[model samples]
Target: MIARQYLERAGLHFYAANVTLRGGELDLIMRDGETWVFVEVRYRRTSLYGDAAASVSYTKQRRLLHSAAIWLTERGGSFDTTDCRFDVLAITGSQLQWLPNAFAAAE
Candidate 1:
């Protein structure tokens, strides 16, 4: 995918893609040095309602959090120790925007 290539070119190491969990899916999983990044890719042909990133509602963020937790658990990782972040790749028409550390897991 173009998003994956873009991230890789920016120096993030690819770990996984299209990771499916019980509640949601992670479009890309990458590593920036020691940080684990969970990326959500959103695409829109036109911004009739809102941009692609804006489509990720609160409920969707919660689902992504749940899925990320499960993914980490399955890999013997812990949220307490593992440094992780959520990112969003928004694609609208021919424009692409990458938002890193876009959201955080609720405390």
Candidate 2:
């Protein structure tokens, strides 16, 4: 809810779809201008293991990327441009950090 609230407050209308069947989950999906964004919502009070953003490992990124590809292929016409990104919204306590282009090409 906080994430949606933040995105709404930021003036970005979004779609939140649960894609657990594919084993790749997207907390929220939104259109940022002409760009399609697959967002992973994270919450970590402290960085005991690591910051929430930092926790998106290569494996996780690959899964998210795969799921995104599936979504694009299934939706058809939803993605016109090659401009897509994996974003991370890290809410550590009361602070909200948005990481754009959170990862490079999926490995």
Candidate 3:
């Protein structure tokens, strides 16, 4: 619910992707015109280990990329690197942080 609102406010049209695969589950898959934005929505009431965006470790990025591949292949769309980016919608308490192109798969 919060994730949807954040995306909507950002002026990006999106949909929740339910890719119940083996490893990971992406929170929301968004569309920004020709760009395919894979959003990872995270919330933490208290910052114990790190911020919500920092919680998305390297392993999680791999999982997101893997799920995205599965989604694209299943949808049968031509693969291209146009404006693809990984976004993180971090929520801590009532504060919201939007990190665009947070990290890459190699990270």
Candidate 4:
């Protein structure tokens, strides 16, 4: 809900939510102009270990990239011509932070 509201407030069009591919899942997908924004939502009650954003480790990033590629393939779009970005929405307590292009799509 937080992530969707944030994207809506930013004027981005919502595409899909909780999209599950074979490898992984995308929390939210939105269209930011011509770019497809694949978002990962994370929530942490307390930051004792680390913040919510910090939990999206290297492995998680790779899985997201793979899933995104699968989505494009299934959607029958040319990846070379399409623009895509990975975003992260971190919710800690009452604070919500949207990190655009939080991680690269490379391993």
Candidate 5:
């Protein structure tokens, strides 16, 4: 919710949220101009192990990619034509870091 509000204030148009699929859940979906953005929100009360962004592992990235693909397909969109990106909203305590183009689908 904080991430969504932050992004909205930053001028990203809100599209969807908490999109659950068989692969995984997409925390947020937004549009920056013409580009579709798939966002993952990670919150950590403390960084004892690692930062919130570091918590998104390779497996999680794969799952996000799969889920995004399915979502686009269901909405009659294709990666070949739709400009899309993956983003991460990492929250540590009261700090929020927005990382755009955080990952990409494997070629």
Candidate 6:
């Protein structure tokens, strides 16, 4: 919720949330100008396992990519032509970090 609020404050238009298709779930989806953003939200109380951002491994990225593809395909309309990117919002304790274009679609 905090991440969604933060993103809204940053001027992105809300689209969808918890979009689960075939592969995985997208925490949040929003629009930034002409770009579509697929977001991953992560939280960690401590950095014992390299913090929340580091938790998004390559395998996770692949899943996210697959899910995004399915989401777009299912909801064609403008989404088919819109530019899209993956983003990560990580919360470690009280700190919040937003990483734009966190990863690309897996090959």
Question: What lDDT score goes with residue 59 in model 1?
Answer: 89
Candidate 5 Cα errors over 4 Å, as ranges: none
lDDT of 2 by residue, 9-99 (tens): 8776687655563767778888778677788888899878777877777788888877887777777743344577777889877778988
Better of 2 and 3 by TM-score: 3
Better of 5 and 6 by lDDT: 5
In candidate 5, list every pair of residues with a backbone clash. none
What does candidate 6's lDDT look like per residue over 32-93, in tens digits? 99888999999999897788999999898988888888888877733347699999999998
The window of 10 residues in a row where model 5 has the poorest summed lDDT is: 98-107
Ranking by TM-score: 1, 5, 4, 6, 3, 2
Query: What is the TM-score of each predicted model, taking all chains together?
Result: 0.95, 0.83, 0.85, 0.94, 0.95, 0.91
lDDT (10s digit) by residue, model 5, range 33-76: 99999999999988988889999999899899999999989989
Misplaced by over 4 Å in model 2 are 77-82, 105-107
For 1-107, candidate 4 gives per-residue lDDT tens digits of 87898888988899999999998998899999999999999999978888899999989998998889899988886457579889999988777888999986653
TM-score of 3: 0.85
Reference-based TM-score, model 4 = 0.94
Task: State residue 35's C-alpha deviation in candidate 6, in Å.
Answer: 1.0
lDDT of each: 0.92, 0.76, 0.78, 0.88, 0.92, 0.88
Question: Residue by residue across 1-107, what tens digits does model 3's lDDT show?
Answer: 87777788889897765546657787888888878888888899978878788898888888888877677767775236345678999998788999988876445
- Cα lDDT tens digits for candidate 1, 7-69: 999999999999988978988999999999999999999998899999989888888889999
Could you list the CA RMSD of all candidates, in the order they appear? Answer: 1.0, 2.3, 2.0, 1.2, 1.1, 1.9
